[model samples]
Target: MKLFVFDLDFTIWNAGGTWCDSTHPPFAWKEGKLKDQENRWIYLYPEVKEILSELKAEGHMIAIASRTNAPTIAKQLLHMFEIDHFFDAREIYPGSKLTHFDRIMKELKVAKNDIVFFDDEYRNVEDIRSIGIESVLVTNGLTKDLVKPYLTRTIARDLPQSEAC
Candidate 1:
């Protein structure tokens, strides 16, 4: 079994507030610095929930690695979408997701090589890769056709089935 991590912001939903865009949620702005906001999910992608279910059944532990101030937002979004059951943990409002990834890996006693991550941002993907985790970049909108190439065992891992794939 392997752990599958994901970044929330641009990877999942394009929430109205984005640190990358220099737009902060009304509650996040304070003294020229951005604070964290609460209670919101930008959007839920079609089949995202289903894909998660398939992964779960395939014995993968799903996790969310997001940079947000309010961790509650992550919980709320998961609960709202009925996707909470799939995640082993919801990391919200973290200063650095790479740090969280390290903690999670250590706590779970899994090697970084066993982790698969999905991120929309190139920087975040690169950061996770630095720690030995493999990450797939989520496109503007995720589709089976787009994701098919990487579903093969070759790019994702060196499983025995790579030849068949």
Candidate 2:
């Protein structure tokens, strides 16, 4: 089976320039702290969720490799947007995504050639490619219009049966 991995911050949603924007130690909320945390949500690009749903139907396993440290972000994603339920794994840290990717592939026993990764940063994409993994860069992040071609390619290559539909 193919493994699809994506970067969380800018690639998935615009968090105002950094992945830790919604958390403490960087920018703490002054009111309803816990509730505020619960209220916060990153807007998902329109096609992203639909494409992911389609990928799931094709037997592709999804995972996330990001630079987030707090586990609450994951919990919030599960409770608020239900995103956590979509991914088989959510790996987060401050360093390279390669670390997370390595772990996920290892744990899942997926080969590098069977995986594709997405990120907005060229550095991240290049690094991932260095490890012999295919990757795409989201120049405009995840706007619906901006990412259609990429979704098309993914659909064509991963789920060819859905290509005509």
Taking all chains together, each candidate's TM-score versus the true structure is: 0.70, 0.72
Tens digit of per-residue lDDT, candidate 1, span 1-165: 778777776666555455323323443334543243553325556667666766676677778888766566555555645677887866676677788787777767778777788888787878887877787888774444444343433245655565545
- Runs of candidate 1 with Cα error greater than 4 angstroms are 16-41, 145-165
Model 2 lDDT per residue over 1-165, tens place: 678888877776654344634643322334523223444434555567776776677677888888676656645644444567778887876787788888998888889988888888899999999999988888766554443344435546666575556
Worst lDDT run of 10 residues, candidate 2, spans 26-35
Q: Candidate 2 at 47: error in angstroms?
A: 1.5
Name the regions of candidate 2 deviating beyond 4 angstroms. Answer: 16-18, 22-41, 69-71, 143-165
Q: Pick the candidate with the highest lDDT.
A: 2
In the order shown, what is each candidate's alpha-carbon RMSD?
7.7, 5.4
The candidate 1 region of ten consecutive residues with least summed lDDT is 19-28
Candidate 2, residue 94: lDDT: 70
| Every candidate's lDDT | 0.65, 0.68
